[model samples]
Target: MEKLVEQVWDYTKHAKFYSYRPNYAPKTIDMLITLVGGKNLKVADIGAGTGNLSIMLLERNCNVVSVEPNDAMREIGIERTKGQSIEWVRATGIDSTLENSYFDWVTFGSSFNVMDRNEALNEAHRLLKKGGYFSCMWNHRDLNDPMQKIAEDTIIEFVPKYTRGTRREDQRPIIEARKDLFDNIVYIEEDFYFHQSIENYINAWRSVKNPYWDLETKEGNELFEKISQKIIERLPKEFDIKYTTRCWSAKKYK
Candidate 1:
């Protein structure tokens, strides 16, 4: 776990590119908030990278505590979310150091995969008041789309055995396994389209944590350049990428 935490520091170099990544679906976010009893609730957003999800929660009128461990990412998050009803904290999902039984909800937006799952769930349970919800979500590219299929082929051409890791996996089992702490699990997935300039779309790849290639290395840079060139040649100046925000949530139990 310590090593995993250390490895996340690598995001320092890629922090700036995070802004190019697609955001979770707003409609799905509203659904999650409604399921947990509507807005104006207190939320702890773990691994709140660059304040993406935190900003969404804030816009929905939730008071948020944005907890992120990486300095570079956290700094960007702080800057992007300045003047909002948010408190930025330096912390990890396994041991957030947040108040016990204080928050109405604890969420991990595109971040639950980076931590020890069971430990993170325990921490979330500890931070939530009775009946509060624990939720985690990721915005996944819809590979079935034509453009996305092209991108997927390009990635496979570079790294044949590429896998998206736990972020793309069904999270119900993990949360359900901890029945002693949580129950009434629900899963929601909503598809949405994101429009971006071709340049930013290519740059968004830089923020991905690909274990197959280290973006800092020469080989990694070469792979990135090749993929970017392919996209530049194949894609239009501005286009939409299909995305699906998949979310899992459960009520905390005693």
Candidate 2:
């Protein structure tokens, strides 16, 4: 997972990674908005890759601080957010450069899986004011969807053994971890629907530094390319891709 995280910073500087990778859905935006009960909520987005989630919060009229460890990714986010009112910090979640009990909401979107889960959650608890919410949201793809199925299967078939099972985006552990730190635990699941051409889909997959590409053997590289080609063949020019955006929210307790 750490290797993947490092590669992501390198890959995301490319146009493909910076522009084509999936963004959070408006439903995700709505959930956070309502969770904090306002548009101008103070937010700290931890492990905020390229400010994807932070940008969303800013658009909803929230004051946002984006904390990221990767300098390249942080730069992309900074450039994308030129003229916007967001503070970009070069720090990780475990030690975000922010005062304690300073924010109303601390958010992690598609980022918690990369964090030291316990430390990140504890940091969030400390940074958020009493009753302030800590929210973590992730876009989990439905592999059953046609185009998505092909992509997932191909990646699974070719992904390097080292990267396998490194990070599972399960919400349970984080939820349970928060239980002892915060009161009033809650979970919400929302769906986002989209239609994409196979070209777009392929572009999206290749945009991220694929673990399949990290396979160190010639056989692995060959296998990955073969699977990529097969994906292009099997997927339709246009197909529906559904993602479930699962969010867990909890309020800091005294």
Number of the predicted model whose lDDT against the real structure is largest? 1
Q: Candidate 1, residue 245: CA error in Å?
A: 0.4
Clashing pairs in 1: none
**TM-scores for all candidates?**
0.96, 0.84
Q: lDDT per residue, candidate 1, 88-135, as tens digits?
A: 988788878799999999999988888889999999999999999999
Overall lDDT per candidate, in order of appearance: 0.89, 0.73
Error of 2 at 238 (Å): 3.1
The C-alpha RMSD of each candidate to the native structure, in angstroms, is 1.5, 3.6
Query: For candidate 2, lDDT tens digit of each residue in 1-254?
Result: 23334443443433425455567678767866886785578899997777778888888888989987777778888898888889999777777869999999999876776657788889998899888998887776776766676777766665535242323456666567568787677778777777777777666655444444633458756765687798888777788788777777888877
